[model samples]
Target: MAALILFSVTVSVISEKGEPAADLLRENVEALADNEYGHNIYCLGYGSLDCPLNDRKVKVITGEY
Candidate 1:
């Protein structure tokens, strides 16, 4: 008998530069993570670490798919 084991994780990063930057960062991270882990570790979401609710600041970034 033979079996295969696979591992996967969802990553979320905090960014201060808004959704655009967060999207870029997430893309980069996903690539690096896939290489590091030898699997597709996708970044599922992103959010601002320090942005306040009413500050007209960056909001949480979510994956479209």
Candidate 2:
């Protein structure tokens, strides 16, 4: 069986409250995944480390927003 390797890139953003916003971060992540490059990138919010808004397969890492 061939293993499929996906490349995920995390983009961090700080909110007004100084907390990671999962929703907003997911939006940016989704946009990257939708890009034409097809690099399989995922957006990780530095604030919302506890709960990620994006898909589990996308590999969302949150920290230090």
* Global lDDT of model 2: 0.42
What's each prediction's clash count? 0, 2
lDDT of 2 by residue, 1-65 (tens): 01111112222234544666567556755665563333444455444343333434333643333
Reference-based TM-score of each model: 0.23, 0.23
lDDT of each: 0.35, 0.42
Clashing pairs in 2: 20-47, 46-63
What tens-digit string does per-residue lDDT give for candidate 1 at 1-65? 01111111222122332423446545765565553332332332344542222333344522322
Instruction: State the lDDT at 15 in candidate 2.
Output: 50
- What candidate 2 gets wrong by more than 4 Å, as runs, is 1-21, 36-65
